[model samples]
Target: MKLLIVNPNISTSVTELIEAEARRSASPGTALTLRTAPFGVAYIETRAEAAIGAYATLVELAEHHAGHDAAVIAAFGDPGLAAAREMLPIPVVGLTESALMSAAQLGGRIGIVAISRRIRAWYRETVDACGMHSRLASIRCLDEPLADIGSVQRDKGEQLVALCRAAVREDGADVLIIAGAPLAGLARQVAERIPVPIVDGVSCAVRQAELLAGLAPRRASEGSYAAPPTKACQGLPPALARLVGREGHDNENEEGNS
Candidate 1:
């Protein structure tokens, strides 16, 4: 199966991190194509950056989704995930929700570890959106600013381990989820140190994407997820405009696809 993994942030280093983890986890037959956002913040730590990520994600998929069976938005926050699902016919997976769901299967209470405190509220909102809020044990983060966005895992490894341990000790988290794109592969690196099962967002997302695409589920026809009606989507990119106008389709397969 062919998959497209889009890193919503503009940082190529973070994109490389995601790509490495994905390569380590993906099956041999699974063809992978990864892309970094041409627009948006270097990394998404705030709600405003996340919004730009959402827009960039939509534009990326709209232009490059052809021939790909599934897509994974590499950011832990999953910006543009829902909109992509609504707009495109292919199954799209987000890192945060994938990690949360994987943690749920591993144990009872889920603990989330991120690099920044600024992301706590937004990550909480994501948990709530995924309906995993009730199962959340706690969220732990390091408040100090980082010198670089690319090497966060290498720089904060010890602190992150401590945070994970505290979540297990203080918050009673039976499972831990290492959140954020930069820390994509940390779970495997430090799994022995943590007592509970730890989930890596990128790994779980890639597996889930394969599972969904393997099923080959049809696009939504009715309900909120069904495609929007064609309208004059002016000033959008050419590919997006064509989708919005339902060009080359017989009766608007994109009424739910667009």
Candidate 2:
């Protein structure tokens, strides 16, 4: 199986972090391709940054999705997940959604930890979209500044573990998800310290992408996930515009139109 992971942030260092975790998590025969967004913020921690990241994710996917069996939007907020899934035939999973689902299955209440408090609201929206908000115990994030976007996992590992423990104790959380693109692989590094299961967004996302690739579910032709109507798109990359316009419509759809 082939998996493509697109980090919507412009930081290649964070994508490398995600690659390390995905390499450790994916199946033996699975090949992983990781891409960094050509344009966007260095880190996506707020709703506005995530909104830009969403467009970046789509552009990355549009240009490079060929030959991949499945794809992952490797940002915690899952910036363009549904839109990507609707626009592409391959299964597209989101980092936070996969981690949250994996954590929910492990225990009842879910706790999420990120590097910044600004992301709390957006991550909350993700939980609600996944229908896991009711099961959420808390969303913990640090309010202070950090040295680097790519080094938070190493710089703040202990701080993150403490937050996890507090979530379990103070917030009554039964399971935890370590979210954000920079913290992609931190869960494994700190899992032993935390009492409950600590889910890694990168790990769960790769496995979920692999599972969906193996299932090879047919693309929806008539539902909400169905290929959307072809329409005019302006000021976008050519490849993305083609996809937006459904320029490569299959014979069946063309025949129907005829």
Tell me the TM-score of each prediction against the true structure: 0.95, 0.95
Task: Point to the candidate with the largest lDDT.
Answer: 1
Candidates in order have lDDT scores of 0.89, 0.87
- Across 1-258, the per-residue lDDT of candidate 2 in tens digits comes to 889999999988998999999999999989999999999899987889989999999999988887788999999989999998877868899998899888878999998988998878888988899998899999998889988998888888888889999999999999999988799778888888999999999999999999988887877788898876888778988867766674664533333222
> Lowest summed lDDT over 10 consecutive residues: which window, candidate 2?
249-258
lDDT of 1: 0.89
Error of 2 at 32 (Å): 0.8
- Once all C-alphas are superposed, what RMSD does model 2 give against the true structure? 2.8
**Once superposed on the true structure, which residue ranges of model 2 sit more than 4 Å away at CA?**
251-258
